[model samples]
Target chain A: MRWKCTVAYDGTQFEGWQSQPGGNTIQDFIEARLAVMFERRVVIHGSGRTDSGVHAREQVFHFDADWSHGPDKLIRALRTGYPDSIQVYKAEEVDEDFHARFSVVKKRYTYQFFEGFADPFETRYFWSTGNRRMDVERMNTAGKLLSGKNDFSAFTANPGEERDDDPVKDLSLLRAERIGPRVILAAEADGFLYRMVRSLAGCLFDVGIGKLEPEDVLRIRDSRERKNLVLTAPAEGLFLDRVWY
Target chain B: MRWKCTVAYDGTQFEGWQSQPGGNTIQDFIEARLAVMFERRVVIHGSGRTDSGVHAREQVFHFDADWSHGPDKLIRALRTGYPDSIQVYKAEEVDEDFHARFSVVKKRYTYQFFEGFADPFETRYFWSTGNRRMDVERMNTAGKLLSGKNDFSAFTANPGEERDDDPVKDLSLLRAERIGPRVILAAEADGFLYRMVRSLAGCLFDVGIGKLEPEDVLRIRDSRERKNLVLTAPAEGLFLDRVWY
Candidate 1:
């Protein structure tokens, strides 16, 4: 039987979502727990990778197991002795053909920004923009210009790194909304390149703070090339909100 | 000159609010910073001490320092090299007669509870009551019974510990409000005994979940003695919200 689980993690103390030599990543912890439960090696696959300090609200993963117990017991077993920062909230059995990584339909990411100095509680999840005032309308205007299917090479980090994934993606939504002292940027796409959301967020933030014009963003996107002009927002401000399957 | 400062701390990584031999308390950090700024050691007096894992939103402190720089510059200097979990946000010069511990007129504390299982983001700030259904009206009824001036020995912890402070206090307000899946209990008083807020929270939580009746709480309060029946909620769920002078 195959089990699919929806999980959330604080991500502040993690070394990203992927496995590494140090064994400090979220995947490492979950896999170790699975190993202890099964008394053998078991591998679980995540929908995608998130950088260190990037939080997840509903990250999906799947693994093959032969347990006959129901989902509730499985959830309870998985949550035992786990750190409070990570939670496996939902679990269910899925068909053998279902894939956690390949079955994705769309993904949504949200970036949080504080208008001024963030309070102690918010500093972990938000990026403080100092005392600068952001123009939400201008940010949205620039975000709209970058929406839809396009070659987002300008927003991709480590352009020199070799990868087979295409640069073009259908960005269905790119919008910014302001609530009190917080500015949230939501982005939905069929697929995102490496650090694509962070790059887009950095560009929109620059536009909102009058560092870049809306037309400048268009020019940068149309160039179809990576440059130093586009900055990648810090990982702490990014959150993987949803992954549709 | 005497300066009053309002600070907030995450409290998850510190020993407590007082100066301890380990030098891991919030006061130790602030005094260390002040020592670095001035040539001599400076002592700061907080409104009160909070236990480990107890958060604060506006914990006030006062200290005497001969500094010519303004409050804004002082704030910036004090914030330098400080961990993100602790923040000193507001600082102002006050009369020498003003004291952080003695001049307080009222203090407000908030205890947070989650109806079901709390998510990763909320685990640090809220106590999960499992799947139990809480009766907010019953909790409030019990809370009101415990309010006003009374000798609240039943809600005090460490009864055998030596102390000169009186157990009688004027509890101006005690209310419980439910917001969606979260229940917040706010308490305002002229002063609180050691672990009094947590004890009150635990009793009210028991009443909310039908483990105790409203009249049971009244009996406990009127007992004027500490007992094993009144549980003290964990420190993480309690927040020192405000201190009024």
Candidate 2:
């Protein structure tokens, strides 16, 4: 039977959330850890794949295992053996047909930064902006344009994916707010188009820095051309906050 | 002529903040970057040395360079040249006798934790706590005891260079507050004995988890015995927040 579990991981040491050739992948590592205890090869499926150096607050995954252990014991074992960068925040038993990715309903994300000189101690976890004051209002206005259902082809990175052919996506929410020198981008969506968050952040950053107008979001959205988008926000600023099915 | 610059770095890739013989260190990397620009070797003196996986908000450093560039231009160039992880937040020309460590009056530190369900995104940057809800209020009450001058030998890790007889430290601030599921520890002291913040965090974490009583701080403080301390808080949570000279 399949069991879905909510997990969290540090993405700095990973290539991305998905399996990759040679590079460390969060899924591969988790599967390895589970394999040791369950004595079987388990294919771990995640709600969504994140990029290198990205983080997730709560990620959903599922795997099939036959064991006498209860959910709590499984969680405890995973917690004890999982790499420091990866953790099983919670564990639950699901019906055999439950799928972590296809069943997910919404996802949330947060991006952070440090103003002035970041405490060197916290720099790894946050983007650093020495002293460039930003216009949060403009970024927020532009962010509002990204809300609702729309084609997000302009914001995706890998345009070759067939997702562009059916680019329309339901963006339930997107907001860029400022905290000190840091910016908090809280976004919620039924599901994200590839690189959509990064693309939106890049545009909002442009607006925040006075490089783009809030109205520019409409034009960018209408164009639906990935090449027409601004820069892709650095992977460091993006995070996967949570997933709900 | 000499200049004092406050620096910030992401220590994930380095051995630590201090210069060492073989591994890459923040100090060595900064010196290398400076050498490439000035065509000569330059040594930087930092206010503190943090360990691997540690971060700093504003780390003060001083260097002697017979260069003609202004602090502003030097700052810009240095920032542009350094890796994204290393940033020169601000640069100032200092009096010849200014010392980053000796002249410092107080230093503040913070420890961050993304408690519960290890978030993949915050994994490297925040410590994770699974299966246990954090008792922030208890941690806060215990933290208050550290606000004034006290014998802190029990709260420091390594405690290198400082003799055991020198256990007294004047602390100006200590706090543990909650922001979301995370805790922010704000600590300031005239000067910290080695590993003091991390050591305190370990004990406080135990207190938050109900293992240590809030009043137990007095026992730990009075014991001046390192053997009684719990595990050192993971390096990832520690941040050099600020300095007041």
Candidate 3:
């Protein structure tokens, strides 16, 4: 049977979800525990691979095992076995064919920025911008230009990525809003190109800083060029908000 | 010249505030950075000495110096030099006789609890009680017994403490408030004996779990003996909130 687990993590402590060259990864750590829990070999598939220092709000993952344990018991086993930095929020059996990576309709991501030195309470969860003032209106307008299906080759770090062969993606929503000095730019799309969210965030940051106009985003979206459109924001500021099945 | 530096730390990674025979200590790490900044030997005296795996909020520390540099520059230097797990929020000059430990007038502490299981967001900052239901009102009523000057030998845990002769303290306030599923106990006092906060928190936990009545707190407080006290609460839930001069 295959099970779907909604997960959240403080990604700072791990070397990212994917197995690293020679370092510990989130998957490696969780698999170690799953291997013990199931008493057999197990492979877990996540919604997508998040980079190191990247956070997730409701990441989905699926794992298969022959054991007949209920969701609650399996969740308890997973919870007790893994380190505190990784948590399984919810667990449930899914259709055998349900794939966390491929079955997702869209993925929503939000980038967070808080003004002032981060609160001792929030340092791990937010990007502390120190004293950089951002123009929310400008950033939002630029975000509005990105709310449709388009070839987002310009808004990706490496346009030559294997997934970039099909750069046309349906961007369902792109909203940049301000809750005081904190700016949360959230975007959801049927699929994302490699580093698409960070690259788009960098463009919005340029707009917020008056370095680029809102219309420039439209030009970049239409051009489909891989020229001066490759600024990837820091991974710490990005969050995998949720994934729609 | 005198100085005070507000500190934040991940206590899980340190052997408390004092240097001891251990892998790492908060003071040792801090003093190493201070030595680098001053270009000589430098030591910091903390307002409160915490046990292993305990954290702080506005932890006051003072160091005498003869440098021409202002306090702002020193703050920047410390912030730049320290690791991400630790942070210096403020630095400033004070009177020559103003000592960090001896001259501190009051200190605030907070203990955090999470329901069911630990949230990854608060892995370092909160204590999880698994499935145990905690009664906030009972904890609050028990907390009231902690006010005023009293012998808190029962609430401490340092059998090899050097400050064994100084066991009495004046507690200004003790409060238990529920924020969401978390019941936070915030207490303030003129001074705390070693493990005092942890012991008091343990008693509150006992009250929360119905093992003891709220009235039992006064009995324990007036006992002036550590024999009947509850077990020491985990260090992760405890924090040195502030130190007032």
Candidate 4:
């Protein structure tokens, strides 16, 4: 049977979501647990990769296992003995055709920013802007200009890296909202390129701080060229909020 | 000149608030920074000591220094090179007679509880009461019975340990408020005994879950004796929210 799982992780102590030789990534931990439970080598696939220090509220994954137990016991067994930093909150048997990676309709990511030095509890999750006040109105304007389907090569990191995914994606939503001292940028896309969300967030922050203009963002997006002008924001501020089926 | 400082810390990585031989305590870190600034060992006093894994939002401390630089520069000096987990946010010169420990009039602590299994982000800070629904009204009723001036020997931990402070304290506030899945228990007192706040929180939680009646709490308090009936809640849920002079 194929099982679908939804997991949340702190990500501060992880190398990233992808499996690596160090055996310290979230995938490594979950796969190790699955190996123990199934008494065989089992591989699980995630929706996508998140950089180190990037959190996730509801990251989806799937693996095939021949277990007769129900989903509740599966969830409990998966949650037991794992580090508190990661939690497998939901589990269910899905159709064999439902792929964790390819079945996605859209994905939502949120980036958090603090206007001043963040408090101790917030340092692990928010990017501190160091007393720079962000203009939400300008950020929204820039976000609107960059919305809809377009070639996002300007926002992709490591252009030389080989990948099969296309650069053009339907960016259904790009908006910024400020609550108290925090500015949260939410982005929804059918697919995202490498570090595209972080790059977009960095550019919007620059626009909000008067370093760049909304028109400049449009020009860069239309050019379909990667340049040094677009910065990739820190991974600590990014969170994978949702992955729609 | 004597300086009063208000600091905040995420205590997951520290031994506690007091100085210890391991040099891993919060005081050790602050004093080490002060030694770097002053070319001599400087002793600092905190309002109280928190256990390992206990957090603080606004813990007050005081020390004597002969620095000529203004408060802003002093704050910058103290903040520089210190770990991001601990922050000395406020510093001001005060009269020599003012003491961080002795001059305190009252202190406020907040203990947080989650009804179900806490998520990854909340595990470090909230106590998880798995599958238990808390009764906030009953908790408040029990809190009222436990409040006011009383000899709270039942709520003190390590009663055999030598200490200078008295066990009798005027508990000004003990209230439980639930916000969604979280229940916050706020307790204010002229002073708290060792683990008194945690003990109080535990007993109130028992009342909240209908395991103990409010009258039972009164009986425990009026006995003026220590027993195993009161449990000391975990340190991570307790936060030193404020210290009033």
Best by DockQ: 1
Ranking by DockQ: 1, 4, 3, 2
Q: DockQ, per-model, please?
A: 0.87, 0.42, 0.56, 0.86
Model 4: CA > 4 A from native:
A159-161, B159-161
How far residue A87's Cα lies from its native spot in candidate 4, in Å, is 1.3
lDDT of 3 by residue, A1-245 (tens): 88999888888778888876754788887788888876776889998888888888788889888658688887777876667888887899888989999898999999887766666557766777776777888888888778888888887665344652478999988888888878899999998887889888888887887788888888888888766754677888888989999
lDDT of 4 at B11: 95
Question: Model 3 - which docking category?
Answer: medium
Per-residue CA lDDT of model 4 for A33-95, tens digit only, reads: 999999999999999998888999999999999889899999989997678889999999999
Q: What is the TM-score of chain B in candidate 1?
A: 0.98
Candidate 4: the clashing residue pairs are none
Q: What ranges in model 2 sit over 4 Å off? A: A109-148, A159-165, A186-188, A207-220, B10-13, B51-54, B105-237, B240-244
* TM-score of every candidate's chain A: 0.97, 0.93, 0.93, 0.98
Query: Candidate 3, TM-score vs. the true structure?
Result: 0.94
The worst-scoring run of ten residues by lDDT in candidate 4 chain B lies at: B156-165
List runs of model 1 lying over 4 Å from the truth: A159-162, B159-161
| Cα lDDT of model 3 by residue, B185-222, tens digit | 88898888888888888888889989999998888878
Instruction: Please provide, for model 2 over B1-245, each residue's C-alpha lDDT reduced to its tens digit, 9 standing for 90 to 100.
Output: 87888877766677788888973888887888888988998888898778877887688898998768788888877876556677886888878988997898888988887677435445566777755667889988888876688888777766456544456878877788888888888788888877788888888888999998999888888887786556688887778878877
Compose the digit string of candidate 2's lDDT tens values, residues A49-96: 888888876888998887568888888778765577788868888898
lDDT of each: 0.92, 0.78, 0.82, 0.92
The local lDDT score (0 to 100) that residue B216 gets in candidate 4 is 93
